[model samples]
Target: MTRIPDQPKRLRIVPISKLAAAPKWQLETLRALREPVFFWFTAGQGRITLGGSTRGVHPHNAIYIPPGTMYGFQAMTRTQGVALHMGDPTGLDLPETPLHLRLRDGSQHAEVAQIMDAIQRELEGAKDFAERAARHQIGLLAIWLERQRSSAGDDSPRGLSSTNANERLTARYSTLLERSFGSALNVGDYAQALGVTPTHLTRACRASCGRTALQLVQERRLYEARRLLSETDVPVQDIARNLGFSTPGYFSRAFSAHTGTAPSLYRKARGA
Candidate 1:
């Protein structure tokens, strides 16, 4: 299946060890993004914290993390892997949460690695229409993963087969927040929309994501604020209004409190 081209065409392939070379603060920060991440772990082992659950990852584990989920991973050993960062402005057919698949079969593992290599080559070769070629490769990878998920049947990954209440509620909350954050939705409003009490929502959020319900909502907003400040030419006041803040002052206070930088300063620093 061909991926629709309506979404932004940004593709990056990088090794996992780059994290070790990056600044300490960048590695320590948890990220919520508007893109899905595909990773193939070829060496080393570590744990992945995905929303409400943590899973150990080793060689041959492929992770498909959906947009809007909070995720972070660490490599305990000298890790090497291929990671694909894909933007999704059109709400493409990405997973709703994280999928950790262990390719116990050597052939399956090699096939995935080969596809990733192809994506990397297409990206680095810098040929004409390289972006188009990379997107096609990603679409193929997505289809292959879907096939594996279908064949897993009853013994699929716990993240897929299990329906833990806290996990379910937290996933729903994340999805809702991804769509409703700009509308000024609060914890109570979110809880009501999800048909649960604010207290229960907070409890579930903490149990699953290590964050309170209100914190999750605020964090999403702050992430958007930071993203806009770093990537767009929109005025600070305009961004504030669009993100549901009553005034630029309130937005600046919140942004500074959460991000330690005012909007204008962040934009300038990031060269937006």
Candidate 2:
């Protein structure tokens, strides 16, 4: 059966199969961009730096860097690989959270690299064969992601997935936060979905990120509230309800706890 192409405008998903397999990477050479680039080093290992500080990304590592993020890289060893460079036109806005994905040692590294390469080939040539190839490759990629989740043992931190587990978990949790932060007030719920216990999840969250899982959830909700108050004519009561608050007074109190000023005053100060 012929399948619809998975190409998104402004989001180029290139599989390495079509591109020159071995493109040399040089740290001394700088490549600046006016757009964000999401590169997946599926096969080779490399290290990156920003403003002289050593940045870390290796094989099976993928990165979503915003335009002008000021970064560079050096290959740790000689290797050939594929990369996907997604320019920021698709409005697939990356979250304000971390975008770096580092694969764990001894994870299904080769399989992940193969998945990326297959996607690149499909993207490069989307003919009937390529379409099927892309679909198959995407499934493999999902399987690798799943394996990461299942491998996080009892000793593993809550968000730890073996194959870029922490990063994948964070991305999933970030999506959940955006969708139901106001309503889902329990970290355990998020942990359950991520195949982790609440405590481990929180620790993984704090280690991979400087903030607690609860903090991220609350921050996202609060930021939404602030945006609504400042950008629209929504009343405080309605806004509170929209944010899953039972009462305007409660929302106001919570908002005030996080920010020194109450929601109404903060909105007014911003002339909203």
Candidate 3:
């Protein structure tokens, strides 16, 4: 069956248990993804670590982890869940930081469940304009989440209108990184663009995601490098130049340091 059809090719929907089977899940440090993921836990309990924060997850709770966020998931019970992996889904707004929410009302839970089912159906049977239709459904889910936060009383300060200052700054920095990663932008340049000092930006990054601003830029660069290597026949030297690297040797060293493999071999291993 199709999973997250009509969504970006990188987007995926899969069972939580299957995700947990990856080798990184057993390690003390979990490898993160280049896209955001929302986990809907139907049954059982688990613990999700996002950045420097860890939270407990129960049935009917939804957890979101943004891209480049270091995270790990653990299930203490027989966890049954659906993971929605996303890539800049347009027309949908969500929290910038990791989120864990419990839909205590039966109707609320039912509505969310229905939306997820509709997403699956669109992927499976909607052959015409399927991507557009699926996006509309996904938008509905985002609106549903926003409504829940609004009705959730004062604790919903994380909404678009009133996200925490640190998180907002970090989110802004993240958005800028997404748009400008191809250029040779430094941390100071990013800070200047955001109208904040490099130190202030670093403080915000530390408070919000437990990573430095430089790391974010590097991560984005590496993500792009890997994508080029695995999805195209682009020569490593050409890829390096495209990504603004001064030399192929530097790119190769950086790639090796981050992935523990040379760029060409990594590409070959993925059957590119």
RMSD of each: 5.2, 13.4, 6.3
Instruction: Estimate every model's Cα lDDT from 0 to 1.
Output: 0.74, 0.56, 0.70
- The residue-level lDDT of candidate 2 at 244 comes to 70
Query: How would you encode candidate 2's per-residue C-alpha lDDT over 19-121 as one tens digit per residue?
Result: 3333332232223334445556656555653321234555556555544443445554553454545444233334322244555665456666666666776
Models sorted by TM-score, best on top:
1, 3, 2
Candidate with the greatest TM-score versus the true structure: 1
Q: Over 4 Å off in model 3, which ranges? A: 1-12, 20-39, 43-58, 63-79, 85-100, 125-143, 157-163
Off by over 4 Å in 1: 1-8, 19-36, 44-52, 66-79, 86-98, 127-136, 153-159
Q: Backbone clash tally for model 3?
A: 0
TM-score of each: 0.79, 0.44, 0.70
Instruction: Residues 1-272, candidate 1: write the lDDT tens digits.
Output: 12112224466887888754664334433455667888888898887756555568888889887766666565445777877887653524555557778888888987898889888989899999987887888888888878777677575563355647997888778777767777777899999999999999999988875778888777666766666666567788877877778888999999888778888888999898
Q: Model 2 Cα RMSD, Å?
A: 13.4
Deviation from native of the Cα of residue 138 in model 2, angstroms = 24
* Greater-lDDT candidate between 1 and 3: 1
User: Clashing residue pairs, candidate 1?
Assistant: 52-208
State which candidate has the highest lDDT.
1
* Cα lDDT tens digits for candidate 3, 1-272: 11111213354578877765544413223335667777888888777644444456788887767665555565544678788876664445655566667777799789888888887777778599866676788788777776776676555522233456886787778767766676778999999999999999988877866667887777667876776776677778877876667898999999899889999899999898
